[model samples]
Target: MRYLRFTNWLTEIDRMSGPISAIWFEEVRRHAGTDAAHVYGGLMATLTAWAELRGVPCEGVPVGTIKRHATGKGNAPKHAMIEAARARGFDPVDDNEADAIALLLWAIETKGGLA
Candidate 1:
């Protein structure tokens, strides 16, 4: 199977969200500079750089904020977040997708509108 590059995805998003608005990026847990943390942190940095190039404001949202907004608890389990998406009538493909969905809702609700 072929996978899309992160830059490609970001380009698509930049195209869709024209005029460049604020980007609400969710901050994941960084455990003393683990690999996961490094990769995610790098991705976020790249994303922020791209947003900067386009003059888009990027804001980092805490993971706990996403969980609390989506599941009513900051420490909700993965399954609970999935259930929360289901409860909201979303059929998220996986936990990551569910997280994206939750963050999307939070961004829309809290940040007025998307770019």
Candidate 2:
């Protein structure tokens, strides 16, 4: 049921966004609990499979890499990431939003603004 909901959400986003050039996600190396780890793995597998079915490029960025790219610190805290996004002219409402913004920026910069 959860996987279905997640795929439905992805479909909704794809419909709204038009053609997806690529997909990027944060690659978490560790989880505090086994259940969380399992959930992450399941979601990741679902996401990759979905992307593959659609022929879209899907990649994972490391947590430390995102933090360093956003705030010049590999282990930057949530508040620092938020500040970094704000500095980049984004008003993120939460850490997740901020992280997304940071990842977008990273992708754009790394891919020479064509991504």
Clash count list over all predictions: 0, 0
Q: Per-residue lDDT of 1-115 in model 1, one digit per residue for the tens?
A: 0123676777887689755577777776666658767777668778877888888788887889899989999989999989999999999999998998999898887763333
Give Cα-based local distance difference scores for all models: 0.80, 0.90
Best-matching candidate per TM-score: 2
Q: Candidate 2: which pairs clash?
A: none
User: Distance (Å) between predicted and true CA of 39, model 1?
Assistant: 1.8
**For residues 8-87, what per-residue lDDT tens digits would candidate 2 score against the true structure?**
88888899985777998998999999999999999999999989999999999999988998999999999999999999
Q: After superposition, how far is residue 112 of candidate 2 from its true place, in Å?
A: 8.1
Error of 1 at 84 (Å): 0.7
RMSD of each: 4.0, 2.0
Q: lDDT of candidate 1?
A: 0.80
Lowest-sum lDDT 10-residue window in model 2: 106-115
